[model samples]
Target: MKKSILKWCMLAFLLISNLAVFAQGGTEDTPEPGDGTEPIDSKLIWLAIIGIAFAFLYFANKRKAVRA
Candidate 1:
């Protein structure tokens, strides 16, 4: 039980730690990637990729659970 709790705590810490860096990135005055006129924004693409990866992990785990 302690090991399972520790594992979840570590996962939560890693996720929160990574997101904390994003919170430091931009202010309302300046914004990220400079002005609003940029043709391409990589952030959206990266967000989508992360979403897909999370979905994949969720589905894979769900399948394992269903089989067992």
Candidate 2:
């Protein structure tokens, strides 16, 4: 009976603490819209993805050859 009461007390404390955290607003130093940043090149991104795919295929074939 004591253990059950202790568990309920701990659970209620945790619930109240979480509600207090959620009630707060964001800080004053948060970033505003249109913060200056350049976009990345899509061609370079695609080239890196293709290179990774080729590497995976090469290793898979090498492993299969070793098994045979």
Candidate 3:
């Protein structure tokens, strides 16, 4: 039992130390308006939403049909 406890303590210490080493420093630069990034298309988002709604309705109808 004592050996198991020691092993867990060592593991926790290594994990915490590695987290500090991997931590990132702050960046100085920030983006401004019209940074030449293309705007996202709204049509694609609507298509995805409609497709998911249809899929859920299709599955629910199928389940209801099976029960009847």
Which candidate number has the best TM-score? 1
lDDT ranking, best first: 3, 2, 1
For all predicted structures, in order, the TM-scores are 0.41, 0.39, 0.40
Candidate 2 clashing pairs, residues 3+ apart or interchain = none
Error of 1 at 48 (Å): 0.6
* lDDT scores of the candidates, listed in order: 0.84, 0.85, 0.87
Ranking by TM-score: 1, 3, 2
List the candidate 1 regions with Cα displacement exceeding 4 Å. Answer: 1-40
Q: What value of lDDT does candidate 1 attain over all alpha carbons?
A: 0.84
Model 3 residue runs over 4 Å out of place are 30-68
Q: Give model 1's TM-score versus the native structure.
A: 0.41
Tell me each candidate's RMSD, in Å, in order.
Answer: 6.1, 13.3, 11.1
Q: CA shift at 65, candidate 1, in angstroms? A: 0.2
**TM-score for candidate 3:** 0.40
